[model samples]
Target: MAGDLVLLTGSTGFLGYIILTELLKHGYRVRAAVRSQTKAKRVLAGPSIKALAPTDEQLSFVTVPDMTAPGAYDDAVQGVTYIIHSASPIPSFGDGEPPAQDQLEESLVKQALKGALGMLESAHAKAGGSVRRVVMTSSTVAVVPFEVYMGQGTEPDRVWTSEDRIPVAPGPYGFEFQAYSAGKAAVLNASEEFVRTRGTAFDIVSITPSWIFGRDELVTDAGGMRAGSTNSVLLGVVLGVKNDAPYGGNAVYGPDVAKAHVLSLDPVVKGNQSFVLNSMMDWEDAIAIAKKYYPDAFAAGKLREDGKQPTMALKWDASKAKRQLGLELAPFDTMVKEVVGQYLELLAAEEGSK
Candidate 1:
């Protein structure tokens, strides 16, 4: 009965779209919350959703455009027994001429915190009595020392546990990455704050997934999808968008991350908790896997071998996710193969269309 009826926000996002299919595959009835019901239907009716064929009377959509609006999710969670709050405002560069760095950081942090609090407060008021669990899609930006790991600053690497403080502010400003990290950190802090004061009406589990790599089924074959910065690293490499730039980290397969969200709904789980998730592969290893598996892409110069490896490598402790959620993270090579292979197919489709 845990999967009987669930309300899922962010159904239109890359991760949320995948999570939708994963939930349906697990036999759950999902009430997708999207900004536009028509757009959601159009996007979902494509080959990707058709391939999955997850249609059911229970699989429906409700419009919630302004997630930050007061009582936004109140009606959405009316009859739902479970919730997966994956919908967070991903920072974008916008049309042209980037805004002031401080302003961008402030806006993103505010929006992220507002959206998170909206979902938490709504769930507490509307669905608290009956909702089983709320699984939030937090990012590794909330856990790892990205400023230190990425060499963006001189901050020393701190021992990061679920209880560690997330520093997203007070100096080390000016970069979009830092802004995004601050936003993610704000969400995590907000989740803990909600749990501590709100008591245990419903269990909240926040999953902090590192860079997610895999073919995005929702994106077109021409590779014009608006993937997040984390995913854009690999996709950008494959599409020649950032051929010379090497980016890598503790990466995880996108589907594996989705599967973790589904697995977190076990009834035995209780209270509030957070888990870091990732595959044990750095950037160089992942690229090697791509070149080995999809030689054609590499040969065509679309997938370059010139990307740089990280000077300061970092490792993630995903044992908590494996232990608590029973999730066995996918291998680096396998995920690389899947992502590259799928990109190749998309490229071919694009060429055929032209």
Candidate 2:
């Protein structure tokens, strides 16, 4: 179909904005479902989006009421032939649920699945013989445990992708990553059940990626901007987290996370093409790249000039994504260096103000 009318949930979100920008590049007719149109416009006006010159009408906005409520996307999913559901919770604090014990089991995860089922049902009804596919954003946490680290001999490349689906962590890392992982796992599992039970209205596929790091798409309001500044905090944490920094997490770039969604959206990739983006690294690897490419800044921070601290290797595999989705990832150094440069500039401005 020429210019597929695509429906994107969580359009106002960080990864959502990147997906919007990338989709716009292909001129895919997109409808971004936002909680508030006015707030969305402000986000669109931000540096990340303003550069794209998104047409108001082309970039249509819809009100996504409450995610917890099912059928929230009923009307929005009406005519959209392609659906990219990149909406999920990334915990800032620990999982707020009473028991971290209960959360690690599968509380939040089942919730997302419930939402996914609602969307799938809506899409099944509205396919109008046109709905081709549904692409969701799963996380690298879905691939396995946090122990899949580096080994002996040559650097055995292993990262999150579509093919692997075994738990590799020590099992019970915590409810935070667990909820996120289990939630994605629920959706993927639910999607499978959907196809098995519903008989393929549109093949369901998902992209499991790592922690996304990039500039905020829209500043939103001052409050929203402040909240969105998590982007910066996460980036800066690397400079200061030092040895005590938490490093056993999966990571990926915002653009790649968005692209993995797009690749899944393309008619070329379907149920057979589901995968994850696991181009993540240990804190040491993360720091090494920072120090190697940005010696001056690294020296300024005085963060491990000796060497990177040791970290557990996480397991990830991306062959399917490479072979099928055909994603050529940018170097890890480039991605980290770019963000570091942005951080350095921000620091300089902060110092100047003082």
Output the worst ten-in-a-row residue range by lDDT, candidate 2: 146-155
Measured by TM-score, the strongest candidate is 1
Candidate 1 displacement at residue 135 in angstroms? 0.9
Candidate lDDT (C-alpha), each: 0.73, 0.64
Model 1 root mean square deviation, Cα atoms: 2.9
List CA RMSD, all candidates.
Answer: 2.9, 4.7
lDDT for model 2: 0.64
Model 1, range 1-354, lDDT digits (tens) per residue?
Answer: 445888988878778888888888888999998888786876577565677676666488889988888889898888777899998866553323454776765566777788888888888887747786889988877865555645665443543555555666653367666677878888887788887888747878888887777767666644444253345565554454433333435788888889888888767765478778875566666567777877877888768776655524455567887787778888877776877777677778878888
160 Cα displacement, candidate 1 (Å): 3.7
Instruction: Give the TM-score of each candidate.
Output: 0.88, 0.80
Indicate which candidate wins on lDDT: 1
Q: Residues 51-122, candidate 2, lDDT per residue (tens digit)? A: 778676667888876665766777888778888887765554311334366555444565666677777787
